[model samples]
Target: MWSFVGKKNQQRWLWHAIDHASGKVLAYVLADHTDAALKSLMQLLTPFGIEQFYTDGWGGYARLLDEDQHEVGKHYTQKIERKHLTLRTRIKRLARKTICFSKSEWMHDIVIGLFINRYEFGLPI
Candidate 1:
């Protein structure tokens, strides 16, 4: 998922793979930018032999997915991309520049993970 720090700030970050078929968010980490984000995402994805993957024209995605069965530069990734937008809208805290409200990084992870699992995965809240 590509996310920005705020509407006023352009600093973007990513959360790793979301299983579109199952609506399971496989992994997530706070990253610095697209490069670092792709590196971590690749690491997380190494175990899975994906037959095909899709993404936007993020340069880092090109580099990492070069070895895999990736389909880039297409509009097919729009679904997962839109999911990020839904998450940002639903989770007010994730919306731009709201506050430094995470109690701690660990707590932030737990809360966000739970939220994603409940809301994104259609699990019972």
Candidate 2:
């Protein structure tokens, strides 16, 4: 998921991964769409012992993930796409044409983190 901080030109990407069966967010990071960012998300998922990865045709995934473990196609990512829709609908700041948006990177990450922690993890904030 992609949103911006201060302006649309300064885009911030939400690098999130969800469980296929449970449809729950596993981990996420707010950063530029770079290999390092994806690497960080992958590291967060390390403890889960991920055996396979379903993803789009992102160059970073191809570079970072092992070929046998990575499957790149839209068909395999339906659950995550649906989750993205839910996120975009619920988070006003994620909307492309929204008046309410994050003015800084710090607040942007925090708000999204809070929402994910509360709703996805069912944690008391």
Candidate 3:
């Protein structure tokens, strides 16, 4: 999902991993849309023993992910896409055309992280 900090032009990307069966976000990284950001998410998921990755045809996924284990298509990505929609509904900052935007990257990450921790991880708020 995409959002902005300080200004609409400053695009920030939310990259996350979810359990295929449960639809729970396992880990997430908030950064620009780049391979380094994807790498950070991959590192966080290192202990999960993920055998396959279903992703959109993002160039970073193609470059970094193992070809055999990665499948780039809409078919296998519905759950996560739906999850993103739900996030947009719940978080005003995630909405595309809204005045509710973060003033800084720190605030943006904190709000998103807290939301994910409470809802996705089932942690006490």
Candidate 4:
């Protein structure tokens, strides 16, 4: 799943693939929430051999993922939703209403990338 950042029309999405068993973020893509964007994320996850994708009823998910492998429902996507909540709590830019926001898409992506790299993946920035 993904969340929007920045103002409307100028917003960007932070798409994520979370491992249910480990509760770790697998891959993420920063882009518009489109089929092409989701396709890129799926490509990144291809090496992991993901057999099933549980996501919301997003048209992109339904269109890109195989019907049999796609499970559309809120119950199945709790982990990712919780991850979204964590992101929102930790990243002020992701908050629903906040004056602090990235002025450029470059800064937006870099900030979020650093956070995920250092905090989520435990890599030194």
Candidate 5:
């Protein structure tokens, strides 16, 4: 449950990675959707090994899951997708069509990461 928020006028991208099982966010970075960002995420999760992953049909995820046992499909990722909805509701920053309270793409990613870590994973932060 990690993603970047790119505003229509923003220049930077927000990167985040969340643990699905415990809902803990692992890392957050402000970068483009380049190989470096993907690599950084992989490195952050490298110690965990090839755990089961569930993602939508995002091309970036395809490359990230190349070495891991990743599962991609609408049905397979229903839980995460639902989680995203929950996240959007809980975090006003992610709500659609908000103008006054907009987060920088980088901060949005980091905030989501923190939300996942604290709420989803039950982490005491």
Candidate 6:
């Protein structure tokens, strides 16, 4: 989970799932970094038939995913971490230490969602 501040410095987590091999974005959810948000991301990833899950040391991953399939470390999660960098570069709201940010949660999500869908997933906007 990655987060950015929205209007009034309200933090919003970007819960995203990506393919390890191809580095393609599978799904994403904009919400708090909580069990419920992780569950929502898991539901989206379920359709992909993912066999392994690489994550950080987040407790939600441990609870939701099978022990055998879950691998915890920044080393294993490099692809997604790189993807976050790409997002930060492309989207001002995602950039750390930037004054350029979304004024509303709705617009913040819409901009990020459209960028991911069009650029990452190759869907027409």
- Among these predicted structures, which one has the highest TM-score? 2
TM-score for each model = 0.65, 0.93, 0.92, 0.90, 0.61, 0.88
lDDT of 5: 0.62
The model with the greater lDDT, 5 or 6, is: 6
TM-score of 3: 0.92
Q: Write the per-residue lDDT of candidate 4 for residues 43-82, one digit (tens) a residue.
A: 9999999998888787888778889999988777777778
RMSD of 5: 4.0
Model 6 steric clash pairs? none
Alpha-carbon RMSD of each model: 3.9, 1.2, 1.4, 1.7, 4.0, 2.0
Model 1 per-residue lDDT tens digits across residues 65-113: 6646776665665656677777778766566456654444455456567
Per-residue lDDT of 23 in model 2: 82
lDDT of every model, 2 decimals? 0.63, 0.88, 0.87, 0.82, 0.62, 0.81
How well does candidate 5 match the true structure in TM-score terms? 0.61
Arranged by TM-score, best first: 2, 3, 4, 6, 1, 5
For model 3, where is the 10-residue window of minimal lDDT? 93-102
Candidate 2 segments whose C-alpha is farther than 4 A from its true place: none
Write out the backbone clash pairs for model 1.
none
Q: Candidate 3 on 1-125: residue-level lDDT in tens?
A: 88888777898999999899988888999999888999999999999999999988878898999999999888878889898888888998888556767888998888888888888888887
Which of the two candidates, 1 or 5, achieves a greater lDDT against the reference?
1
- Candidate 2 residue lDDT tens string, 1-125: 88888878898998999888888889988899999999899999999998999988888989999999999888778888887888888998887656777888898899888988898899888
Candidate 5 backbone overlaps, count: 1
Off by over 4 Å in 4: 1-6, 96-99
| TM-score, prediction 2 | 0.93
Q: Model 3 off-target regions past 4 Å?
A: 96-99
